[model samples]
Target: MVAGDGQGKNIDDLPDEIILNVFSFFSFNELIDTAQNVCVRWKRLAHDPVLWRDKEYIIRGRAQNGRSCCGVTCSECAHCRCEKTDREVLRTAGSMPQLRTLTMMRGTRARILRKICRNCPNLTTLQLHGCQKMNYSLLKYIFEKCPKIEKLIIANNLLADRRYAELVSRLEHLQSLEVFENRRGAGPVLLRFLADACPKLREINLSWDYHPLEDVEYFVKAKRDTLTSATVRWTMAGKRCVVTVLKEAASSLEKLQLHLFDVAPEEEAATFADLGELHNLRELHCNQLCPHRPRLISLAFQPGRLPLLQRLHLPHATGLPDDAVATICRGCPALRELRLIFATSLTDGALAEIHRLKHLQILDLSGCSGLGGCAMAHVAQLPALRTLLLQYIDDLTELQPSLRHVLDLEQLRCLNILNSGHIRAVPFEEFAVRLVNLRELHVTYEEEDEVFYKNVFAEMQSQMPRLRIINTFRWTEDDFLTDYETDDDGDDGDDDIGY
Candidate 1:
């Protein structure tokens, strides 16, 4: 008997399960409202637990936020125009009792999550991306509440507490955790707790933040066995440095990053004995080391070591001789993705040995100050090259000088050279014209005139019409003028040098 909502019969007059089957005709949003209007039996069937299955959790909460996924359940309220629904979604989800997966967006409620955790003990997968207001008290409550959580992802929260490690240690069944770096000094204990409790841990990303150069070795020596895929990022002298520590503990470790460290001291080369132990070492990244005296190249590439190593980043490198680059090219024939950033002393002659990489694609020469036109021209010769970053090569002071040299960037898809201020010499119109196939551009120059910018916009709109994202550029102090005139200019004809 279908009732008079238009179907023209009495559906409330049907059996409980049949009425639920009828209510299921409406969408989840509609079900929330229709559930309230029907008779007690129809309402109970519409409010059945199975109807509230896997509510898409848009939250950045802990995997175990222990919160019930709910909105204010307001019916006919201004916030949600419905016909008087329960003021809490917890009542609906609580009735279900078997809620497993939860993804959340924002949380302005109390331990509503804790109530959900206490009710649904079988919860597994959880992803929280934007719950900025949700405090750690809720997170701490979830950890204590939800003990069986498996996959947990938390991003962008500053919830620092004393017992973060203790709580994580208690989650004996935890696997796959990607935590943001801790703002305080609590992470070390967190690492220790993870190591002690989560014995089967395979993937770990810990922030080796600001460990003085002296302590890096100490920490490495201590945790060499446990860190599988670890990146230690820090700042030294105001430059970005990302140091990756990986080895035995993370036996399945794959990627590693060690950015800008002044490691090239003139001594008996340092030992990467722990790195050699990994046997699965694939990618290694190291940024700007000090100088040639304690050569980093000599330390690692002695004859035929780091054999499993393939991808390398010696960005902004100094003191490394052309012969070392040549040796590595010759030794690591499988090498690819060589990044020579800010290579102040590297010359085009050094790159003559690039024939070594059997499968090279990405060559990042960003900030390579002394690498002028000829060197760039040589780089253009790589047959398999795909992505090239040539930002800030002040040596290419002339525009077309290096622009024409990059003609072979045909295989290129991504190009980043922002603030490469020397673009004034290059005809920006011509580049906007030729590189139509280019996808990503981050080129910038210096100028004080607003008209130059207007031209740039008009040119970009016409030139690279296919561009996805144009990294904005600016000309800082270059927008100013310098005048050089004297009050006694009339005496210039025959005056002494000083006069």
Candidate 2:
């Protein structure tokens, strides 16, 4: 039943299913701290096991005595906060018998962790972040307690022992694993152990300071048939291994990330060619290798090569050619999100082809200085366009026409024009009034004076009170002095701009 029906009923009159559905949106802390005290009905529903199952309980922040904060904001209390937190976790874990995912961040105490894991018998996914105290014994204890764990994300921990590999290999049910900054001397041994032991492993993300070519290739080749997603980072010395990973995982790979830096010229040219053959690839992300290189993207991005490609991110892609962008736009018609930040070589011709992506929703062309007003005008024509980030484009000086075209997109919710200093305040304010559906506006000017922008901003606030306007422009002390020195009677051209 509707809460505000003509019978004069309230939310308490609603069915348990509807109330539980609303309660599902509340965080674990909110449910325990606030919802449980609301009413007798809500108190019972708050303790329901379904509410806690499969939820990601993130334990972060500083606690007294260097223990995990457990979402509490107490520094000094009569009772020991650490023991209180441990009791709370143990009690919460009893309510979450079906809990599947548990995430623990920095400052988590050993006893508290053991208490939660021992109670959460069905826990399958464990993510440990910045837990410096997580040694080999603590991890092994966790593995033993939570034997059903299938996915593990251990980041920025202190597990530098090769003996940790022996414990990891014992998890026969493990399917996905992500290790970052913990595999210093044990990376090679861990990969070798995982290849032979972890039969169900389908996705793996390994990131550290350095990657040995021999170890990476052997692991990739061995698990190529089962692995569907891989995130591998390497330097100039491991170029051949990068190619081997792509070549081996081409058939089954659906998601791939290559964080290649300090790459040799010849190896860089040969490595990118293998990417075009991955027909099953749905998402591809590559980091910048060299800014001075003539072309970072390969010419192999032709039609029908990557037909299933949906998302492509090439951040800091310096010297990226316009034809490559054109080819990606034409070939990857199923593309939904595209981010080519700092790709300076792109022009209007490349952006013109981008409108062909009928399903495109998010487009971030930040720092592409080569694009001008015409390129932006074409980008605003995408029907499904919701987020448009055109930051750091100095050549987009003609704001009035571009803003007029942009305001026509009824679905456009976010527009980012940060660091584009040439935009006039009056025209921007005028066009912003028409973009009624716009939820976010990110704009900044490099001009010294702030008087003109201040007036425009005030007017915008009065006109579009619901719109979120983020301005990164900073005014200097000289601009304030200049404003005070100038006569109020003097013509500042505000009249000519029709403001």
Candidate 3:
């Protein structure tokens, strides 16, 4: 393409920096398969290490893509689809010697990881997810190869023993560490290692259970000045660690998530009360709340308290009243996202207060059974609102009033109304007409009405060609019995249908 100047200069006439900047937008796959073959200059620019510094190469498996099993490697195996992809990834990783981050997903072979590790010496972040039985030797090999790694995440993977901690402690440059799962072997020993050895650690997310309160408190206290994000699961016996986190890391802590097992009513109340002073908090999620609910109300209800909070997730606010919601909305002026999932006791009145949140963009009121169609009027008033989730909400009938309110949301991009039975053909058609800005829509239908709604969805898709619609069918009790009905030969017809 020629530049629109009098000289009619071609793209190659531009400086190498400008051409490389343009090349940066292309995906690694595009760079390898297309750009590299485009021209000599383009290929050379495409191979620049600066482009791959933060590009995370994801290596996922067939199970992740909804398959039973990825192909097995036979003795005389021609490379399977997965094997081909792995070979491509290793080749790409080898080219990018300055690669900073690599994410290997489920079913990643250890040999492939070891190869990538040895190639990318400047690697700073390594994330391995859902690849179970990750022994210490593999981790040790990775650490030895990528000595400059700063952020490490091993989520949903089963670890062998304490050697996981032993390997992690060697990363002197480590800043962020996340090893989250219920079935991990690491306990308080991991926390002890992090507190003692890893001085530069600023973020820690360990979802392992049975971490004693004393060890938890000591770790946070030790790194109070540097720790910016902390997610820890501790026993209920030492709930005072909540206070320690709030008090010690009050100035520096930006994100805080605490998971406590077997928490009593009074202990929950105390924990909520202690959260009043964390002024620097940007995100907060503590599942359990006091029965009184007023303790949390005070923290969020007061002016200038938790002023910088952008996201507040309270999933267990089962019986939260209207006054509490009103107070939260009134106080947290800068809140961009608020999730009050399963707050069953809330009514449409709470949303009226939420309309005051001028900067709010994402709101999730899923499982708020008490909310009806009328609440959407207030929800639609949020100017910056883009994503709204109202899954399993009761009485969201497809009436003119509700449909009109939802259509008023001109900026809405994503809407999820999963299992919301009352919203049928009329509301969706109305949405297809007015909600043109919508990019993604998730809806569910009962088994009996599936075919009818599928047709309705087809028409909607034609009207809004840019929209992505995800359809789900909620099976009825009768459908289950029909599937198991015996035939004349005493054979169940279930074998013919795939679940």
Give the TM-score (vs. native) of candidate 1. 0.57
Ranking by lDDT: 3, 2, 1
Candidate 2 residue-wise lDDT at 170: 86
Off by over 4 Å in 3: 1-15, 34-44, 66-93, 107-111, 129-138, 155-166, 182-186, 234-241, 288-301, 398-403, 425-436, 445-499
Best by TM-score: 3
Clashing pairs in 3: none
lDDT of 2 by residue, 1-499 (tens): 3455577788877799987898888765667668878888888887676776635554444232322224222223211122224345666655555567775544345566767787777788887754334555566778998998899876523323356676788898999988777433433334677777878888888645455676667777888888898887744134444654557878889998777555567665555566677888999887773433545454446788788988899888776788878888888989999999998777777777888899999999888877755765788779899898878766466433454577767688888888866766225665455677777888885567578777877788777877888887454442221110112222333221100
Task: Candidate 1: list runs displaced more than 4 Å.
Answer: 1-140, 144-163, 172-187, 190-192, 209-227, 232-251, 259-268, 272-279, 291-294, 302-304, 307-310, 315-324, 398-403, 425-436, 447-464, 468-499
- Put down candidate 3 lDDT per residue, 61-173, tens digits, no spaces: 43332111222221121211121255566666566565676655444455666778888888898776553224556667788999998998864233224556666777999
Count clashing pairs, candidate 2. 0
User: Which ten residues in a row are the worst by lDDT in model 1?
Assistant: 77-86
| Preferred candidate (lDDT higher): 2 or 3 | 3
List RMSD in Å for every model shown: 17.0, 13.9, 10.2
Residue 230 lDDT in model 3? 79
TM-score of each: 0.57, 0.76, 0.76
TM-score, structure 3 vs. true: 0.76
Report how far residue 487 has shifted in candidate 2, in Å.
Answer: 66
